[model samples]
Target: MSNDFYRLSILPHVAIVIKICRAYTNSQEDFEDYYQEVCLQIWRSKDNFKEQCEWSTWVYKISLNVCLTLLKKKKNNYQNFASDSLPEEAIVESHAFADESLNQLFDAIRQLSEVDRGVILLYLEEKSYQEIADIIGTNANNIGVRITRIKERLKKLLDGKIN
Candidate 1:
């Protein structure tokens, strides 16, 4: 790895990898494993990253793919995963709500299909809809509509409005 690449490409995105891993894996141990896996995948794929898309978008695709694969493998093993053991740094940095409310929101997010949760997280991060669509391979116009439904669903979950 070139020093410039490390300095420029990889360093900036470490937090994103952690966030994605946390959202996908839930457990501390699993988060560590997934984080390492994402790093490894990014390192291996660096040579092939044709620069056709923004670096962050490319990284997001790789990270999400790795996370989904891990989720599928874990599902086959019947192991339970909960997003309760969030990293301390993440808890300190999060501005969404109090711990209890954030926990509730995380629980609600977990109830969403993986793709929906991805959209919600990106939305929360204030990513432009075009960037999010590129990361998730969805139409930009559809993102707004999907987000509307997702917000309604999440609100129902949060309010105990879902029977």
Candidate 2:
């Protein structure tokens, strides 16, 4: 895609990239890196796009894959800092969101298994179960079951922090 086409194609889906990247990254720096890498990969991969799915679904798939790959690379190259272990001040400083509840939701999300984090983010985006399954490479039935369990787990994680 040309520069203008790439910009227009990816612009509407930027929030999808941000939410997935945020769940995968603990620090603002990592988040920015993930976001930029996703966009770059999307641009590079544009020619590979078949009309197999909606453009947004394709964007979701690309965003999740980039985040997962980058996160694995980070884990391999550096000391792993478990999200639950981050100090209160660092969590507040690292996330861009100003809302405490939104930050708490993301913190709880960070504690989920990486796959579950992708699943729940797509779920929150109001993607249908089959759409999520298509992106996450699972059956729709599995997506439904996983979303239920993920929600229950998140509620426990955020029992007092949100609402």
Candidate 3:
């Protein structure tokens, strides 16, 4: 992707993609792969964007779908269509963890099912339940219930009660 495209289409919503990528990948290399794939997919699907919602919300849906799809594909079997250059390659750390607790939180989050991981990541991003429901293909009430259950599951995982 070109610098200008990344700046306009992705930089504005990079956090949403980055967080979803982070929650789904087991290692830095996988995170980078997922990030690049998400960016490429975004650009590939640009014209398909119907503008039914905010650009950032469209970004969230694409990012989540790409992450989930990549996770389902075995590592060696996946073919990447991304370019060698990425905006992040020119700047920023591979992944930024603000604190140890944040790392612990992500670790716990990784233990959840893929769909649940997206739910909690969206929740942490402060997206409204309705927005999350839209992305997850469910209603707001189910999202609320899922969030409650996901939190409890995360707590157990963090407490070392589940693996």
Candidate 4:
């Protein structure tokens, strides 16, 4: 795709990228890195899009893959670093939503397994089970089952944090 085509096609799905990146990262610096890497990967892989799926679905797959890959690398690097824990400054929350409940919800979401986090985020975005299944590369029925379990887990996590 041409630059203009890539820009126009990817523009509408920026929020998806931001949300996935934010969910995968706690620090602003790491979030920015994930966001940039995702955009770059999208641009680089634009030609690989075969139109078998909706543009937004492709964006979701790419964003999720990028975040998961970067998260793994970040974890590995952190293990090698001297500090056992990240600095307080490196643990900033997005705070994009000022609501305490929403923040707590996000905190709870962050605690879920990486795949579960992606599944719930896609579910929260109102993607159909089939659509989420397509993006996450699973059967639609499996998405339904996983979403149910993930919601239960999130509810249990949030119940403690919120109350």
Candidate 5:
């Protein structure tokens, strides 16, 4: 039973960890480091998962926390930062238009504040406003307004770059 539980409960989080690492880091080394850290955190916190929310939601919260902690640490040592190693296959599969324009968009997203990046990532992931709010510890109403503003900002930024 314990083995079964471990397989079912813990194994599924690997993909989530990968997604979070790719979203947060720029190089392969950094992604591996972040992914390991996230896995360690999830392992340590497994007992604390009360199941108050969906499993995916709980995993997302853990990933967010891990990413934020790493980001904070990296900010102090910016010069030593490594580039992210996003899987080329994943990018090709998900971003059918992985062109120069898309790369520019990603670069622009990296310029935004951490909170904004989180919000936009959740938005792009097709999460509902309520779900995003719940994940980020904000109210649904606020998330809705913020999302609209974020969309406008992203559009303007993209337009300026593309045209």
Candidate 6:
């Protein structure tokens, strides 16, 4: 059953899940834990998928919720640091990412608030503002405002101007 749903959700959206898990965790062990839990939850809830939105969108919602719930349970605000590199498979999965500078960009993005991180990740996936809003449960206008602010914040982080 898990394998069936994994093919339906995890295989295609694995990179998005990896990126979300990466931003929400600080260590490789924690990452693996989160990744597994997210996969488990997706399998657990597989039957509930209504096929209303794209399956990837549903996966994004589930992945973000799992990461945020785990973050809340751990009671730790994730750090404002970035990894020097990502897992090779994740890098290969992220076909949009062109160079090492894109890694710097993700580092900056990781410093954002959890909601901001979700918005930016969806935006990076080229999701419409409305799609992002629907996934994150906010208005499209609010998502637009948030994305604008998140971009400015990422700029500051990348410039070495922010602590």
| Model 5 ranges off by over 4 Å | 1-7, 10-15, 71-103, 160-163
TM for every model, in the order presented, reads: 0.73, 0.85, 0.81, 0.81, 0.71, 0.78
lDDT of 1 by residue, 1-163 (tens): 5677667887798767766766665456666788888888888898889989878878888888787677534542232243333333333222333566766676567566677777887888788899889888888999999999999988987796233
In candidate 5, the residue pairs with backbone N, CA or C atoms under 3 Å apart (3 or more residues apart, or in different chains) clash, namely: 26-83, 26-84, 27-83, 27-84, 27-85, 28-84, 28-85
Q: Put down candidate 6 lDDT per residue, 71-118, tens digits, no spaces.
A: 433423234222233332332222224575666676566557667888
What residue pairs clash in candidate 2, if any at all?
Answer: none
Question: What residue pairs clash in candidate 1, if any at all?
Answer: none
Question: What does the lDDT read for residue 44 in candidate 5?
Answer: 79
- Predictions in order: lDDT: 0.71, 0.81, 0.78, 0.78, 0.67, 0.74
What is candidate 3's lDDT per residue for 1-163, written digit by digit as tens? 6888899989999988888988876567778889999999999998889989999999999999998777444434222222122222322222348676677777677667778888999999999999999998999999999999999877875686334
* Residues 1-163, model 5: lDDT tens digits: 2566557875776666665565665556667787778777877788898888888778888888888768535543341233233223322212313486766566545545557667887888788889999999998899888888878877876786685
Off by over 4 Å in 2: 72-94
Candidate closer to the true structure by lDDT (higher is better), 5 or 6: 6
lDDT, candidate 4, 1-163, per-residue tens: 4678557977788899988887777666777888889988998898899999888999999999887766345653341132224343443455756788887787667667678889999999999999999888899999999999989978986776676
Clashes of 3: 0
When summed lDDT is taken over every stretch of 10 residues in candidate 4, the lowest stretch is 76-85
- Those runs of model 1 whose alpha carbons end farther than 4 Å from true positions after fitting are 1-8, 72-98, 160-163
Regions more than 4 Å wrong, model 4 = 1-7, 72-94, 160-163
- Candidate 3: global Cα-lDDT? 0.78
Selected candidate, larger lDDT, 1 vs 5: 1
TM-score ranking, best first: 2, 3, 4, 6, 1, 5
RMSD, every candidate, angstroms: 6.6, 3.2, 8.3, 4.4, 6.6, 6.9
Once model 5 is optimally superposed onto the true structure by TM-score, how far is the C-alpha of residue 59 displaced, in angstroms? 0.7
How far residue 133's Cα lies from its native spot in candidate 3, in Å, is 0.6
User: After aligning candidate 6 to the native by TM-score, how far in Å is the CA of 147 from where it should be?
Assistant: 0.7
